[model samples]
Target: MTNDHDVVISGASLAGCTAAILLARRGVRVALLERRSDPDAYKVLCTHSITANAHPVLDELGLIPALEKAGALHNDARWYTRWGWIEPRSAPEGPELPYGYNVRRSTLDPLIRARAAETPGVDLLLGHRVTGLVREAGRAVGVHASTPQGDREIRARLVVGADGKDSAVAKFAEVPTTLHENTRFGYLAHFRNLPLQGGIGQTWFLEPDMAYAFPNDDGVTVLAVLPDKKRLPAFKEDLEGSFLEFVRALPEAPPIDSAERISKIIGTVDYPLVTREPTAPGLALIGDAALTGDPLWGVGCGWALQSAHWLAEAAATAAAGRGDLDRSLAVYARTHRRRLRGHQSVAVDFAKARPFNPGERLVFSAAARDESMARHMYMFAARLIGPLRFLNPAALAKAAAVNIRHRSAGVSPAR
Candidate 1:
């Protein structure tokens, strides 16, 4: 069947733009639709922390240079636990993990959108809001959208929902999602002249709360707090006040209040943990449209770009070749599940606001004392490696030994 395009992607966010560029470069005709017409508008309810795992994707898209030039920070990380600080070490070659971007969505959205629109086989449909799915014989085949011009219908070989958490395509297609409760809502703001040391970010796994201090580009720091839901009364009473006080309460707290506030304090409450099967018939989901896990770890941006790459590779020739598109979608779905399910499972547990289990105690404790264990933990957190590899037999043994040594020395193990 001849269609107007090979793929009609809804939502011009990160995933939509990435997929359009990739598929168009693969010689597939793409129609990229965006609900917003403003080129400068961006997502504000995000931490803007792109994990190191996304470096390869950015490099492939030729965006790394521009991102770094835009003031992205290549900062090292230091995790503070009750036992002490767990500073990961690198080899003589330098930092083992590649640097991730802290670029604001304002800067990145335009870059990604412009790149997608400039591609040869892509048609950018701005001001087009998708209202429903077009299905044939129970298979999603296209999208029905309302544009600034008027209502429109576009048929395609595949429909990609790169929309945000409340995806219209997923809703119209009746895709099932398992919503996990997120007890710790996040509040953050960008600050200027935060006086970071050696450009290292901080993660405090405090007893009942957690905090992050990331040095972004342009000499600005993105500081944030993830407080339990029960603290809503205090937080709601004063967003900025509660936010500042919480940071000051951390051990060896920085002079955050002294820094110039570059942006208003932004927050999100009871953000739902959304998980769904990424493929359904001729429809596929990417970014938050696929799986919205805990935001505390800040993995959403990286996963969005990575999922787009996965789908591009899997379905590059499905529409043109005489291959089964469903089979190609299956490959993408299976790979996505295998690569991310373990991480998501663990994240769901943390999202529940429960304290760490014994295994977590041993791992974090060992990571604090041993360089090898710290490297493993760092790599896992950076998402360069999967959860299984991070908890390999040798690593677990090292963690156990580290805790044993701490006990022998009369030092408290990390809880």
Candidate 2:
């Protein structure tokens, strides 16, 4: 028997939940399936930080109030170089408006799924695992799923794969996915009362290695360190202690030693990530499933929500008779490619090599040397300005000029 709906979404994480909420609001009947039995399930290995641009979508979804209640921290980030800290300048609208935020996935994922359940046209199906996809003449028309009771067939005009980097739906659809080799690994954990300059996020760039501290809502700070894959053996031996030591070794590591750890010092060797094209045929992949970039950029959650919005807009338009499923899928692919392909390409390129270039050294050094440069770099770090936008011809020229002037004055650019 076929369980019918206008759309069927697999995976109930950030991307899945957001897509469901948006589509349901458009009066489209949606059957959102999550393999997990828990309705509040979320990704355990995520950074859970989102950019300021993503806040608009949160507002559109009416999630701001709930997020605030959940104690999400507004994260205005600072970039630390060998020179000094480049702090985010104050904006009139405050931290949330100018910078991004940090909310644990444990808090955010459930909040989003709960909102999906409240959506009028949404049918939340927990503990149902999709075993296969049902296709009609080379187009995705439905899905075959395993419910606790038994096997079931769900037929829909559109199928969305919101699963993470490893998407089962994309595999079943036989969409050719491109996978790249990652050379870095990550270690992370949360600590309480860490003197991490409470209320803001900081990232320290240590040439080939990187470390970051995010002051989350619960007065707990999440720390992550990205190191080369070759160091895995040493890292595994003392995962927790080594991670803390690595942070402390940085030029401006917070006084984490004085704090109490709330969670185990968990670590994963996969620092970088891979992704396939986000959409194909009758199925669309969002979030990590589509294009997982280096987590070092902290763009995953924001991209997930943004991609959901794009997919929802396209899906809704198609369902409302303005377009067909194929057209909708094409629109989603184009929108997604336009929004993130360049950034992802750049991130991948950098992740594969050492972390810095001479140009980066000059820019960061200038920020440490000049307060104005620090503020500008902070905006760029917050993603308010794109790579070229911040490192524009004029900005680069100014940084170069500053370097030359400082050198002539017998001041060396900070390493």
Candidate 3:
């Protein structure tokens, strides 16, 4: 038998769940198919940090209050370079530079699915395993899935794939993806009673070695290290001991050794940066299903929420009879391409685990000295804005001027 809705979303993670909430609020008939039956299931491997790009979506869903109540931390990030720390000059608090959010995936995932299920126009089909696409005339219509009772056929005007890196929907639709090789491995763990940062997140960039201390709720700070594959030998012998030693090696190491670890260290050895076309035919992909860039930047969750918002807006319009459904899909594809491609391209480059080039050293050195450049670096790092448009000859010249001044003062610019 055919169960029908205006749209069917597969994978009830942040992207799929957020899309369901938005569409349901707009009175669109939406079915969210989640493979996981347990309400508390989430991606354990994720850092669970989302940049400010997700603020609007969180506001629209009325989730900020709930997130705060659940002990989510608003992260103010500090970037470190060889010269010194590059801090964002305080702005009058507002959405323009809103603090990023951090919450454990175990807590956050259940919250997202529960909220979406509560909305009026949503059908939350938990424990449904998607088998294949339901297509007609070379366009996706829905998905064939399995529930505990029996096989089910779901039909919809559109099908959304919010599944992660190995997306079943993307595979079923034969959507081509571009994958870039990543040359580094990463490990992270939660530590308790770390030195308080007043809600600030710290990142130390030691050339090819990257470490972060993100102060989260529950008075615990998450520490992560991403080092080139060549540096893996020491870690292979003693993961915990080597990890602590590595942190202690960092310049002015962030007091991690004095803290007690709350969770076992988790890691990923090799993963590729992936990008895919956001939409095709009657189908669309969001979150890691569409683009899985370098996790070192912590943009995954934000992009997930943002892409869900983008898709919901387009789907909402089509559902309300304002435009052709296909046209809306094309619009999503265009906007997604325009916004994320450059960022992913840059991320893939950095994922090679190479040391900063001369140009990067100049930018880092200058940003440490110049307030305007530091603000730009902060904005770019937070993903509040992309840097390509204004990072031109003028920016370089300004950085060069800073470098010249530092040299005259007998300060080194070869960071």
Candidate 4:
């Protein structure tokens, strides 16, 4: 059958734009659709921190130079726990250390979207919402989109749902999904004059409660709090005040009081984890559409970019008529699951709002006093390695050894 485009991707956000750019570079015609009419529109309630795991993908997309030019900060992460700070020491000599970008979505979204729009084979369709799927013999052939001008059907060899957590494409396609409950609510806002030490981001694991201060572009620092759901009434009663109090109570918290609030306090009170099957016969799901993990871990943005790269690489040959489309999509689905499922499982379990268990306490305490352990923790948290590798016997044994040495020497782990 003839097709209007090689791929029809819904939701012109991070995943959609990245997929379009990558596929277009591979000579695939992409119909990039966005429901929002405004070109500068962005997701407000986001961590806005891309993990180092996605650095290779961003570099491949040629976004690093542009992101740097746009004043995005390259940041490592520091963690605060009851045992003390877990700050990994940077390598003195060797290849340059990997780092992630800290740029507001307001800047990031528009920049990538504009790149996609300007690409040769991408048709950026603004104000186009995917209303339903166009299927033949139970395989999606395209999408029925509602445009400002009128409803239209765009036919393609593949349909992609990059529309996020509540994906309309996934809904219309009836993809299987599994939901997990989150017992924490969150709040975040940007402030000026709130700089982090060494320009690194900080995350405080206040047991079940969590807070973060990520230094962003243009001298702005985004501070956020994720409190247990039982504290919802206190936050509802006074969002700004309660937020400040909670953050200030943390050990070595940023000077939020001395900073100027540059943005309104915004948040998501109810964000449940969502996992969906990543593929169907003629369709694929990327980013949050496939798996929405706990935001407290800050993996969403990085996974979005990485997933898009994986999808483009998997489908480009088939879309260009060099291979079988179904086989290509299946490959993408398997790759996505293999790369992400472990991390998603751990994040989902932690979202249950429970305090750190014994294993966690041991690791955190040892990490505070042992630079080697700290580095391993950092790599795991940055998603450079999966949970299985992070919790391997060697790492656990080292953690135990560190704690034992400290105890024998009568040296307290915490400051």
Models ranked on TM-score: 4, 1, 3, 2
lDDT of 1 by residue, 278-324 (tens): 99999899999999978778899999999999999898799545578
What tens-digit string does per-residue lDDT give for candidate 4 at 1-415? Answer: 7877999999999999999999999999999999999999999999989999999989988999999999999877889988878888775674555788999999999999999999999999999999999999999999999999999999999999999999999999999999999999999999999867767899999879999999998888889999999999999999988999998888887887899999999998999999999999899999999999899988899999999999999999898677899999999999999999999988888899998877778788999889888888988988999988888888889989999999889876543
User: By lDDT, is 1 or 2 better?
Assistant: 1
TM-score of 4: 0.98
Which lDDT tens digits does candidate 2 get at residues 1-415? 2445888999988888899999988878899999999886668776769877677789989998888888998877777766677665654455533655799988888889999998998999998899999988888888899999899989887889888787898889877777666677887888888876645788877766778888887777888888877777888887876787788887756887788888877656764466677776778888888888788888889888889999998878675445687888888899888878777766877787475777777788887766567767767655556777677888888887777877889976455
Where does model 4 exceed 4 Å of error? 412-415
Give the Å error, residue 197, model 4. 3.0
Higher-ranked by TM-score: 1 or 3:
1
Residue 212 in candidate 2 has what lDDT?
89
Could you tell me which residue pairs clash in candidate 4? Answer: none
TM-scores for all candidates: the values are: 0.96, 0.93, 0.95, 0.98
The C-alpha stretches of model 2 lying farther than 4 A from their native spots are 1-3, 91-97, 320-322, 408-410
Clashing pairs for predicted structure model 1, backbone only: 71-217
Off by more than 4 A, model 1: 93-95, 410-415
lDDT of 3: 0.85
Task: Please count the clashing residue pairs in each candidate, in the order shown.
Answer: 1, 1, 0, 0
Worst 10 residues of 1 by lDDT: 91-100
